[model samples]
Each structure stands twice: as C-alpha cells, then as structure tokens.
Target: MRAASKKRGIEVTSISRPIKPSDFHDFDLILAMDRQNYEDILNSFERWRRKEPLPDSAPNKVKLMCSYCKHHTESEVPDPYYGGPQGFEKVSSMMY
Candidate 1:
C-alpha cells in the first residue's frame, strides 16, 4: 500500500486501526470497504447507542467506500491481502 501511494506521490503515513464507536463523534464520515464492514459498523453503533445516545444522523455518516467511486462498478473494495501484488494494484487504482 505504501509503495502504491508513494508511486502516485502520496504520502502513506496513516496507521490502520479497528473502528470504534467514538469514531462516530470524531469523523464526519466513516467509509466501509465492504458490505460486511458496513454492517459491522452499524451494529457497533447500535450497541454503543444503547449505552449512550448519539445523534440520529450518525448512522447516515457510514457508507460503502465504493459508493463514491465514479468509474468502478465494484460495490465493495475487495481485500487485497490475499490477492498478492496484482490485487493490491487493482484496488489501489480504484482509490482515485
């Protein structure tokens, strides 16, 4: 991922972390890479909301990352970890 981004002149500095309920309050948008992730985020939010109320609009902030892709027909970004270098390249190309 770093190599791909660096090739495009983008600095890949961010670390990967698991999503948390607090993210609902911290970020304007939460993009999930796939349907499972999207559901997981909503489920997490629902569980968190039961403990403390969040704005009704919080769920709306979560979205499928590919929904924003104008050129790709893929509904989800496939996990590239098992796809090897070519798979990583394909997913990286979809980023923009």
Candidate 2:
C-alpha cells in the first residue's frame, strides 16, 4: 500500500491490517472505496452485530468514501490495479 501511495506521490507511513469486526466499534466512520467494498464492510459489521450488542446507530457508520468527495466525477473510485499510472494519480488527486 505504501508503494502504491508513493507512486502517486502520497506519503503513507503507517502499516495496514485486515479489516476486523472491532473496527466498527473503534472508528467513528468506516469508508469503502467502492460498492463491493462498502457491502463487504457492512456485511462484516452485520455479522459482528449479530453475535454482539451494538448501538442502534452502528448501522449508519459505514459508507462509500467517494460520497464525501465533491470534485470526483465518478460515484465509485476506480481501482488502479489494472489501469495506468494516471489512474492512480487521479485517485490520489481526488483523495487530496
């Protein structure tokens, strides 16, 4: 992930981990890059909520990150894995 960010001139010094159920309780907001990711995160939280007690407001915590971006042209941010460097740079700029 750091390498990907570096390619787009974004500094990423922190390491990342697999998403966990506890993330729903840890972060105030959880954002996903795309619809698939949005659903996946929600599903994980749903599974956790099924086994544990969560606040009634917990279901509203997860959302699409792009929904917060005003300048982005697309509703879903494109995954740059199969695209060129420009795609990565575009996503980086949109993020900034």
Tens digit per residue, CA lDDT, model 1, 1-96:
777767778888898899877888899999999999999999999999999978788999999999999888999999988889877778888895
Model 2 over residues 1-96: C-alpha lDDT tens digits?
455577767888786577887777788998888999888877777788888877667769888888999886778888876578777767777776
Instruction: List candidate 1 segments past 4 Å from native.
Output: none
**Stretches of candidate 2 exceeding 4 Å from the true structure:** 1-10
C-alpha TM-scores of all predictions: 0.92, 0.79
Q: How close is candidate 1 to the true structure, as a TM-score?
A: 0.92
Candidate 2 lowest-lDDT run of ten: 1-10
Q: For candidate 2, what is the TM-score? A: 0.79
| Model 1 backbone overlap count | 0
What does candidate 2 score in Cα RMSD to the true structure? 2.4
